[model samples]
Target: MARPKNQEQRRQALIAAALDSAGSKGLRSLSLADVAKRAGLTRGAVLYYYEDLDALLVEAHKAGIQRFCDRRDTLVQSLDSPGDQLAAAIRAGLPSGPDDALMRLLYEFDVLAGQSAVHDELVEAMYTRQLAIYTSVLEAGTASGDFAPVLDIETLAMNLVALEDAYGLHIVAGNSHITVDKAEQAMRAASTGLGAPPTPDGGETPPA
Candidate 1:
């Protein structure tokens, strides 16, 4: 029906607004009014789409994760080499910089994970999904003899995800020296240590 379509559209708008507000102000300070203002809608209208701030945040966090996953998928889709795929995944996983709204939102949810069951579940699911991406890449690389025979794929994946989380938080927290390029370089070095092929050009591949 027309009403359902309108509702869905409004819902998406609110989510987009929430992401924008979170990007600028950080999720810790995000409010219904901020989201409503960003969406050019009233608070009541936002409430009509989402039950409350927490509900809206949960959905927004999921949307952010989906966006990141889609980007990584697109970046590696045409790459044939597993080493290249792993490198692309690393670059795609990190935020552009501290100004990255989606990454900011992700960390915001991470800080709140233990506060409630919903938050904990969402955080766990997001982490699991991220780890899965790395695991797949590592396994594929090993299978194709592009990567060393990694005895523990899960541990390697966890390490990469953890490194990404730490680096992303530092960048978002205004570590001006810790640029995205530096983060990617560090990740590439770590990947090489894990038995990936070393790039002669310092792992600088075409932009994903």
Candidate 2:
């Protein structure tokens, strides 16, 4: 007989399975049975962890947010320059490609924003968190004299987040011409518009 999973293990397994299903089948089509099948568990086993499909969806969304935030934080820590930091943040925030499950799931929740109160709250909180990340980096750059002092940090931060949201949606929607490279270039242009200094590469020239 196979060994039984502990409570935490089982919960994590189900969450992983949920993301797998969302990635492969798209979040709109994700079902409890699909998650159970991905996890190699029965539907009853899935219920033991999550009360319903909504509960699992919420958990899965939270997991994706945590993963994205963690990755951006780690990437920022390795770089010293503010321009580099800003560039890194933009690159990190974007989806890897159309096949990126985490970004796809995030945008899926975004599409359902007004219909579900729970989803609306999650989306709001996510926006706040993302904006804060940009604000922190921009503030640090300004204080360190690396970025232009004339810029409005809050507005720029909000714009960056908005750009990411729009471009991410386009990428997830499978625009064949809209690759990650193009998205990053657009973000870099926005960053320069905000008076950030040019990066070493020819691509990241700050606005005068």
Candidate 3:
């Protein structure tokens, strides 16, 4: 049991190292050696856990999706009001800040796939999940009479996901102008403009 638990911990460590490395190395140039060095483990040790670099990358991409998308979906579902759900979704979706390596890696995955169709597929999967979060939340808002969407819900959902991705890219790129707070505020404004304003109580700070 101890050995298996240790292995799972090491695998998570490698995934984290890969995300951090991608922020510096970029996905196109990320290599097994970089992840090994970042994790403070030998190449052979990494190999012991993953079949190869691609295997490790696939796992890393999965972790990114879980953190960025799955967690946001859970957060949205926990809220009872559509306004609060949308607000929390907006809050949870952006980068924590300029040094948010996970969000940075997620943006890079889309831009730096190079020749790896695997990377492309992973990025697509993340987008689908991202879009779905907004879709479900907005639909609930409409159903609950919280939103009178100006645009179709599908388009609105796509736009919200696009806004999240664009703002997140800028934030992780260290755009001094696009702070997380500013991004969230802008998104909330956009949501209201698009006809999904959170109610008076829903605009509060989301759970960390």
Instruction: Name the top lDDT candidate.
Output: 3
lDDT of each: 0.81, 0.83, 0.85
Flag clash pairs in model 3: none
Give the clash count for model 3: 0
Off by over 4 Å in 3: 1-10, 23-30, 200-202, 205-208
TM-score of each: 0.90, 0.90, 0.85
Model 2 agreement with the true structure over 1-208: per-residue lDDT tens digits: 2245577777888888888898889877888999999999899888887899989988888887887888888887777777778888888889999988888888887887897898888898889888988898889989998888356899889999999998998998899888898998898887887787537453244567
- In the range 70-125, model 1's lDDT, one tens digit per residue, is 77877766677777778778877888877777887788878897799988988888
Error of 3 at 102 (Å): 0.8
- lDDT for model 1, on a 0 to 1 scale? 0.81
Show where candidate 2 strays beyond 4 Å: 1-5, 202-208
Which tens-of-lDDT digit does each residue in 1-208 have in candidate 3? 3398888899899999988888788887888999999999899888999989879878888898888787888888887878888888888889899877788777766764655878778888988988888898899889988899999999999999899989988999899999998898888889899999865433554465
List candidate 1 segments past 4 Å from native: 198-208
Tell me the lDDT of candidate 2.
0.83
